[model samples]
Target chain A: MSYRAKVPKPTVKRLSLYLRELEHRVEQKQPTISSRQLGDALGLTDAQVRKDLAYFGQFGHPGIGYDVTNLVDRLRKILGTDRTWNTALIGAGNLGRALMAYGGWQQRGFDIVAVFDQNPDLVGQWLENHRIRPMSDLAMLVKERDIRLAMIAVPADRAQEVADRLIAAGVRGILNFAPRRLDVHQAVSISSVDLALSLEQLAFQVSLGLLGSLDEDDD
Target chain B: MSYRAKVPKPTVKRLSLYLRELEHRVEQKQPTISSRQLGDALGLTDAQVRKDLAYFGQFGHPGIGYDVTNLVDRLRKILGTDRTWNTALIGAGNLGRALMAYGGWQQRGFDIVAVFDQNPDLVGQWLENHRIRPMSDLAMLVKERDIRLAMIAVPADRAQEVADRLIAAGVRGILNFAPRRLDVHQAVSISSVDLALSLEQLAFQVSLGLLGSLDEDDD
Candidate 1:
């Protein structure tokens, strides 16, 4: 059974960060963590931490906090990183190439096994262990490599078409970096990493005049 | 004064997408948009849309809908896009260098005017209009260019120290690609965008089985 089916979108996102932090705590020989403790570590509120964890069947105690090792394992299982997944990068652009080289993706349970590009210059090159391929071979690659997840880092204009092709090739999940929202079939779950939105999040905080000057750096 | 400080995190994210759609509606000369119509366009519920928007300020009418032009303006102001921003980038790795070359950042109101790196190999290289500089010159760059925002695409281990230096130098907002939490004083907004989180989100979706074999070409 998919553990995520029962969880909300916000809960799922927070679980990834929480899992990482829990692993760190476990390594530090911390035996238990309270909701407030975890929240503090992440700059979140105690209630928010408890509410997010509650979605996955109450892993925390009333007062003693949560067992570090157990929470990590439970969250890992819920996030489906208990198994390995083969991820394909559809564009060999700078962002896609950087992602292939990031190294954290592998540690987090993903392999960028193949890369694609339409340009002759890029297609002939090798990225890490994977070789870049011409776009003509995408379908063959999807079948041969059994890649179920595709990351679309192509330009905005081609993002939708590239996504359509990835879906056509049987990929079920897509993480899009294009500025535009992509249209996909009901079965495809696309999550866009809008760089603007990330920056805008900061801009909103700046507008608050919270630390308009240098006082925020004192702590 | 910030309409976003009152809205939920998820609501703010959805508003970005909503504003994009609202702009299109305005261009098409649509009279107004009802909560139901807005929800349908984005595959959400009418009540849910109402709830999300209500957190900011009431822009939708009781019986009719929202004024596209007015709503767009409200969203822009809430998002803090009333003026453009100049951004600096630290650690001109492949990711940073790629971002400098990409035109998307410019369109999003952030100008990539400066780059910093400790690697002497890239110190003299030109990225678009800006030359990569040695780390020693970071503080001066922040002041001379009036750089309020920065993008840190450095390695995870170096992220905190680099961010600390940036914060110390008076950077108000940061978009970090580092996979760790940053401890900073209040008023300074720091957001870390982990590449693996998006993949994990997809994995969670797959494990949950909310999406079936989604592909346009799937038989």
Candidate 2:
């Protein structure tokens, strides 16, 4: 049984970043890495990296640093990425198709087992290896494939409708790409990717004339 | 001149959420909103909402609540969405096209002034209203349009190369859709949307069997 740790959300996010950095190190055939080295790569301080890792467990040695292969395995197990997860995609539009074609999800062990769309024109069309199915088939497919996670890419107006259906079909996690706030039940986890929010933050910084000044000091 | 506040990042994110909720309220013809009502709508605590808004300044009186029109205008100005920002898109693939077609950006005052691609086949294609130009013309167009913000939706392998070129062309802020960690100078602000990271976090919760129990307890 997996016991829950009281890991802060920020720490959880940092762990994901660490896992990504470790994957890169593994690709480069680096056998070990110091906290400073890993921190430098991700723009974090060494103390912050060590502190974040300490929340999980003790890792690395006093002088030799962390064993790359062993730490990677540990992180994968901790993050639950060592096992494959079957996911359902709920829209077949441009955003949905782009997500289906994204190589990163499959590379990191999340598989899009089925695709669903509301439009009859898109139904039965092939996307990658999976055929686009209709919304009517969602319940049956979720049960048959044991899909507990879903990705919502429909228009903002339809996002809530699709989410209601997914939750009713027993999906417990949703990654929403539509720029809308979803009122999901407490038991369900929903992460939203608001593209406009990011742009607004950037705009706020630019408005303050805070961008492009770092290189000036260096020069 | 726009003054930067020492607001926490989480507070900034919540402000955006509050802005979205207020927009919906406006659409529904609701004029004023209390902190408790707004908190309940967004799954945040009333106290938390009050504290977050307090970072900016006083919004509502003790009992009367906030005027929706005033709050929305204040948020827009604070977030820099009150003014239009000309932005450049550096990849003309599916993700780029989806973002170009996203109506929320235009509604919130971000205009995709130019589109760029390294692929010759797509260079001359028209997306939305902007023609896809070659990367060689990025500097000239950025200068001509005074574009300081860019969005990168290129493949992971080419993301860094495109980012380097964007920086060299005098772009200061980037909203990267590519699932890769970008290395940039401290002066440039980059926000990344890694789809896999969200999936992995969901998988971790699912693995721990932490789904569907909250509502049961609540009920």
What TM-score against the true fold does each predicted structure earn?
0.86, 0.81
Tens digit of lDDT per residue, candidate 2, span B1-219? 544445544565466678888999999989899999998877677888888788668467778799988899887877777878889998988898888877877887888899999999999999988889999999999999989789999999999899998888888788788877677865586666677776776666666544432111110
**Model 2 bad stretches (over 4 Å):** A1-5, A23-71, A208-219, B1-8, B21-75, B209-219
True contacts kept of each: 0.47, 0.40
RMSD of each: 4.9, 5.2
Instruction: Note the DockQ of each predicted structure.
Output: 0.36, 0.32
The reply for model 1, stretches above 4 Å from the true place, is: A2-5, A30-55, A58-67, A210-219, B2-7, B43-56, B212-219
User: Model 2, A30-98: lDDT tens per residue?
Assistant: 999999998887667788788778866847687889998899888888777887778999999889888
Q: Which candidate is the best by DockQ?
A: 1
lDDT of 1 at A106: 77
Q: Kindly provide the TM-score of model 1 when superposed on the true structure, using C-alpha atoms.
A: 0.86
lDDT of 2 at B109: 86
What are the per-residue Cα lDDT tens digits for candidate 1 across A40-101? 87657888888889877766888899998888888788677887788889888888878877
